[model samples]
Target chain A: MTAQPTQTGKIIISVDAMGGDSGPGVVVAGIAKSAKKNPEVGFLLHGPKDVLSKLVSKRRVLDGRVVFRDCPDVVTMQDKPSQVVRSGKNTSMWSALESVRQGEAHGAVSCGNTGALMALSMMRLRKLPGVNRPAIAILWPSRNPQGFNVMLDVGADVRADAKDLLQFALMGASYARNGMELTRPRIGLLNVGTEEHKGRAELKEAHALITDFADQANFDFVGFVEGSDIPGDKADVIVTDGFTGNVAIKTGEGTASLIGDLLREAFKYSPLSRLASVLAITSLQRLKKRIDPRRVNGGVFLGLNGTVIKSHGGADATGVSAAIKLAFTLAKSGFAEKLAARVASTAELEQDAAQSALQTK
Target chain B: MTAQPTQTGKIIISVDAMGGDSGPGVVVAGIAKSAKKNPEVGFLLHGPKDVLSKLVSKRRVLDGRVVFRDCPDVVTMQDKPSQVVRSGKNTSMWSALESVRQGEAHGAVSCGNTGALMALSMMRLRKLPGVNRPAIAILWPSRNPQGFNVMLDVGADVRADAKDLLQFALMGASYARNGMELTRPRIGLLNVGTEEHKGRAELKEAHALITDFADQANFDFVGFVEGSDIPGDKADVIVTDGFTGNVAIKTGEGTASLIGDLLREAFKYSPLSRLASVLAITSLQRLKKRIDPRRVNGGVFLGLNGTVIKSHGGADATGVSAAIKLAFTLAKSGFAEKLAARVASTAELEQDAAQSALQTK
Candidate 1:
């Protein structure tokens, strides 16, 4: 590949332009809005040239910051992830990920098929050392000062063993350090109860594993956390299987929508009620923005070869653009490589600890 | 058993009055109200005589319809299930379950420790012929006229085999027939996706196993359902493991709370909006009442020799009262016997089907 435009110290984001429900139109619009404010950032659009050209022409101001590669094929949301990723190498999702793998872009963002992208990335880009399964780690709004907590394995691995969970904690910790700029993130396993022996066999095994690692000063591994702690933001990183994560996220989304409807009804009682509601509107709006899934639409698939961010398929232009910016920030953070190195070095600590225990016995 | 209190189609519900958050006060109150509405129902309150006497005195009007039996210890919410049930044979939860198992009561209700209740009931009542584990089946409110969909194995078997899921479906089908008054209930397996090849190994194996059963005329078993379908009431019975069920229910509860909060905020806009809200208040309240989980707090643990229902630990007086009424209704419903009979009758179908398939091959 020829030399692409560099943005000095700013992050370069390669986005799958022809992804999501509205395709490149929303993505391009979102990027246009984001690029105006973040001038230091650059975007590489991967999609059909004709579709993106029309959308780009409408937004004249986004000219310098954005560029495109005419990728013909687009991965549909319903497509079997493995089948398409293996055969359709020239698809927008694949092309965007290729940019990151080849070091042509700092990060890649897609609002298309998540499963396909993850499967493809894992097959193409080797997993991080000790990471049996790479996970989709995302930020969730919390009551904490950190704005939100990070959760992992949202849609990557359905059934995770002890080793997989350990890797999730590691990858999540790394993402928190880089993505959220946490110096040392507190990690916790999502369990039924807070007690040490309160979970299933896999969770129990995972707890012992993480605790053993924590003894070695590998990372800040906290104890088990309950389902209630997820929204409470008690831990910096919450690790769980993709099945549970998907359910939890969807439940949050559905519940948020339901509550919004309730609040609307509560304010319509009387004139005084309306006045009280008006007073609370700004504060409530701020809270809404905080918990809004759209605002935090982007998530990073950690333990992959490169920075691969997945945006919500239903995102509007604003959401798509925020995702692009988030991807750039994550890629430039240098957290992935740092995390890989940290994991590699600390792996021997576990082996050494096992040996010590045997000798002591 | 003291001449078996009115054996003429009268359902006798024996409740551990000391089981719930509100204790016998709420249970007695609920029984009083329900007895007034349905005189055919009889009640047996199992707990300490002194404690239950005070509660019964408060509802003295229904004294003729209810009787009190003395039992001592209570299973605390945090107790280890298996150990508690094994040791505490004369506890309130155990006595309540035993009353049903011994034919002294048709059904039993408890708002006490779920794990303890499940363990005690499973041990005391025993599983049906093919059922290795009993499942706690709950009714989740959906948008359909069927009122709600049933989710099973909510906390019975944490690590389930293919046989466990099929048995769950069979038990759930029987419940739908007896409790729901449907001749043949539509059953669906709770899974990530509908594809036969999707989900975990357990799900795949279960899916393949159920196909044989579904082919016969026992019940209409629909293939698979996602999380969204739980709220949609698309099927009569939805089957999943204890781990997934616990997470899904927690997510639903959390989501419902979030939605209730959102609706409270939505109507606080302006003066004209307040009047619009007034017009919509009745409809909204109607909607809230429909989705309120408190209405259906009691869940039956199916596939047991006796009928046992688990109420939420945090259930208040109204919620506790509902559980008592539900227990009484289910006792008369003859669900347990019908399920046992149905499974026994279908025993030959599987063997015959296998033989026929072999012959054809």
Candidate 2:
């Protein structure tokens, strides 16, 4: 609705206003909520300019805080990741990431298809120097003092070799430091058991490589962990290949959803139980808030040239706001810049490890 | 304890009494519960003679139904699987499997270390004629009419090829029919997405092979299903490789545990909330009972020559009984014999599929 002034000093996030299941209206509402809360945060919203303007008009709080980018095409969930990279230039998700790439926005946030977003981000922003495949990292609710643990490669590339895994450990450790403000993070490679000879061949190799890299990278290597330890207090960061990580997270989410649905059903069984539900509403709400997926709604793409956070495709207003808040915080912290510096040194060290491994053999 | 007379005509199961966290006392209690409930079921208990006899003597229901086997050694949870396969002869777990191998018991049940148990089963009983990898299938609580869905390769082996996955489909379907009594089970391959092109290379090959053999195998192929669909009402059988499957189930269990802990903490926050928890105890208990992991505690090893079930290593009396009941049901159904007949025809079909693919190329 208004021409944006020079907010070059402020942390401006490139927001994809389309592609999410809740549509652009909720996206506007989410950003408006964020803008009202943080004076230093602004948004470069990408969508159909006319449609987004009408939605923004209703939210007077976002009158001067938003800069609209007219992206005519919207990326659908059904679109293949490879196809989108070739011909999805005008899509809101693409435009949103482009703003960050072109230095028009500090970082980008999108509630879109995970595969497509990761593919587009890699192609547009390119990978960091030594990063073979980019990873998607998310904060899992945990028993730790930080309230959450980080798990990587949730749904990026489906494969990661020993060297790639070594990179993930470094990138993940860096993420913990910048994102969670932890000085030294505990890194664990996800396996079936905490045994030396357990899991796949690559895992065994990765375990050896990561153990060597941990001290140099300034993180504690908790050699191996099982799926249960992902949410447990054993490690602050759990690293696994994209395929396993994706299934594991989805399974966790599915189980949580099932428990919630079953609890609601339990509370509705009788008239007395229905009255008990009202009395326990506050208590149940507290439990829900603590484990709410929406509260920690951003999946940050690691090993990227720029900061990109992928919000849940079905995210509502609250979820979208959570993603926006995360992007703003990371952008302010200059997490991506610092991560690049850290990984730049990793290439030489990885090569030396490879050389030593070969020589020893 | 009274000596068992003629269990040759009964559904006698070889029970490993020394492995579970609760020890032989709970194992004895579990079989007593089973023996009391089902007069036809009996046990060939494997453990130290003196210890097992002392425990079983206390349970009057198992007086005539139990036969003691003197096994001096016990398989600890930390025992290496490979080492156990080579030299764990006198251990209770090995003795338990030997009974099934020698045709002295209809089936075998153990609460030993999973990897060790699987290794011993393969070494003692061997694989079926056409099956490459044996799978550990468990009943996952779902919203289906049967209230559970079968998921395979939970941790039998960490790797499986395309052919191995097709066999998993056949074996999982067979498990659904016998274990859950589903006539024609609907099978879905686990992946990150339902798209045919998604997931690792082996999954795509498995998808094509499973689809081709679905009709011949007498199971409905639901193409690809995501991790969320595991607990959903979509399919009766969900198949995946052991590595991914293991992570998924463990992740699901971990999330459930987290929610349970948080719910308990939430209820203790305030006096009113504590009062509300008391009024809602019945409702909460109902929810807990519906999804109790101990209630459905057996992980059946399919693609093996004989029936073997691996119970949770930490199982108490209730969990142990659940595994025993499952063993009794499968033993009575002659599920192993029926599955063998079905898989006998599969070897020829698989060979033909491979030949056709090679010729076409």
Candidate 3:
């Protein structure tokens, strides 16, 4: 374990520079971009020192800001989560997470295998005091004034019981506060319908538990929200089991991409539409930027002992930078500690609520 | 129940002309549109006689095709499924379904509450022999050359066990063969991942059961598919529990609408872009037609004794016409009888497979 570095008015993010689809080049380039914009941010870059040094030396913005750790092992996309946890101690992903675990860095970011990263994170950071399972929270582009809504348990595991859902609500609310700067974010339980009697029995039980703990958790419980409400302003945080959340997120993305492709094809259908496309190129670029998945590229592992931002495996420089920026923001806000304390304080109340709700059922 | 109308050359469709958000006017106009194009189709219009008679009398296309059945009660959107089953006998929705049950009409279409419509259909028409649950299958615009993929169990029930999923596959395959004119539809069980070990326990059980029964059911079982594959060319039919299917459908719709609005806003951002919009309007309309929900407005109730198409509650004249056209197509092809036979014969195999899969687990 690395020694904890004293705070010196700067935030240090541990970056796993290997395992991403694009390799170490994009990760170093992304960190350089973030460093240029945020003078208060520094990086503990993890990978083979020789390779990372070559990339970092080419980028002037990275000068005096990157501390390289020599880690030759890489966790491939094919590696199972369990396999990685057992024999991946020397890998860059593990080393980067170690920096956060040891308190040497404020947080960790990886653009690697999601399952493996999540496994290593849970093994290394462990679950927060009472969290039965950790969740991965992502910021989805939405109709909210803030432009995004937080959805959790996107794929940490397939199932979430009533108690687990209550924990997700608290964690998601906390993330919304720190990540999106929302105060007392409105929370909604994701369901097939907004009606109380609708959805699976577990969802109904979770709804009651969340409602019972809403005031104590310092968030407004907006009750049930449907899939269409994911982008609507009806809820600030949508909570569900990983299975539904994962499917909904992917479905939304697939639909957006499909529509986007059709739009492009439509624009080039005829010579007249082609000329119009040129004239509207600038405005179209603006719209593209607004909905680009890269702008909200990171999925934060919540309910763990430390914060870990999982970038998309195929993220380019801009996407990686967005993830790094998120990690920096969370680190600067001391989000991990705040989240742990919040979960710890409410553990007892959540359990009581879950018990009563189940007993009544 | 009314006596079964003697089979004439024209196929008869029972239309619930009340209970839709737009009321009887849209229903009459929709039937008129369908009748204008298809002289072989006729309607058994169910609603209050004075209202429906006045509306139908004004439509020249429906002059000889419409037969009115007076049903004074309307099934409001707020009616619960159980409540509707208990005492909604005189409602237009019930009357419309009754026409199908009594064999007076080949099929039925309604734009009333989904839960209520499904309940009445299940109660009056009953489930096909050996079917544990009936599923609602919808056509989703996709990249397939056929331009659509069938997804089942979208909201008939919130949960589905292994055996129920097998039933959905069989029913969905029957629908694709009749409704979409596919010879042998490719069936994929919806899951979070393509891996066999992924998703919920029931999904794993379903994967095995579907695989075991695919040969006898006459559909190619493509195994597990992710949400992103819903619009992809990987499968012609995607089967899942109603809860997940419902959420994915709404999420897809929500995302497409959000992007469409953003594109419109972008095109109007500047005078240059506004000019571009005018030039692109024709192409845009073409694109809209390709993905219009109104074009595919009906959800077919599968595994029921009689086919019932549930149109969108808020469907306008065009949407209603699409639903009516779908009902006519299914009726003409004798889809209801085929689905019933398919489910009946395969039910024993499905149950045996489910038992084996469970015992192995």
DockQ of each: 0.24, 0.79, 0.81
> Which lDDT tens digits does candidate 3 get at residues B1-361?
2225434678889999989998899988899889999888888999999988988889887777878889889999887889989988888999998888888988899999999998888888988888898999999888899999999889999989988898898889999999989998999999988878778988888888888888888899999998887877899999999999999999898888888899899998999999999999999999999999999999999888787999998999899999989988887787777777777777777778878877887
Which lDDT tens digits does candidate 2 get at residues A33-119?
Answer: 898888888889999999999999999888788899998999999999888999999999999988888888888899888889989
Which ranges of candidate 2 are over 4 A from the true structure? A1-8, A357-361, B1-5, B357-361
Which candidate achieves the best DockQ against the true structure? 3
**lDDT tens string, model 1, A1-361?**
2214455555678889875898677888888888887777787889998888888888877776667888899899878976886687889888887777777778788888878888878876678776667888888766557877898877787878776787788778878878888877889898766767676888877777777766454468778875556665568888899877766665455545655654566567566556655655565566577678888889788876677889988899778877877876775667667767777886677566545544553
| Backbone clashes in model 2 | 0
Write the residue-wise lDDT of candidate 3 on A1-361 in tens digits: 2335544667889999999999999999889889888998888999999999999999998878888889989999888888899999899999999888888898899999999999999998898899899999999988999999999989999999888898899999999999889998999999988889888888888888888888888899999999999988899999999999999898898778878888899998999999999999999999999999998999999999888999999999999999999998998788988998898888888778888877887
Stretches of model 3 off by over 4 angstroms after superposition: A1-8, A355-361, B1-7, B355-361
Better of 2 and 3 by DockQ: 3
The per-residue C-alpha lDDT of model 1 at residue B52 equals 81
Pick out the ten consecutive residues of candidate 2 chain A with the lowest summed lDDT: A1-10
User: Tens digits of per-residue lDDT for model 2 on B1-361?
Assistant: 1112247567888999988887888888888888888888888999999999999999889878888899899899888888898889999999999888888888889988998999999998999988889999999989889988999989998999888889999999998998888999999999988988899988888888887788878899999998998998889999999999999998889889988999999889888878878888898898998899999999999988788999998888888999999998988888889889889977898778756654553
Pairs of colliding residues, candidate 3 = none
For candidate 3, give the DockQ. Answer: 0.81
Docking class of 1: acceptable
**Cα distance off (Å), candidate 3, residue B39:** 1.4
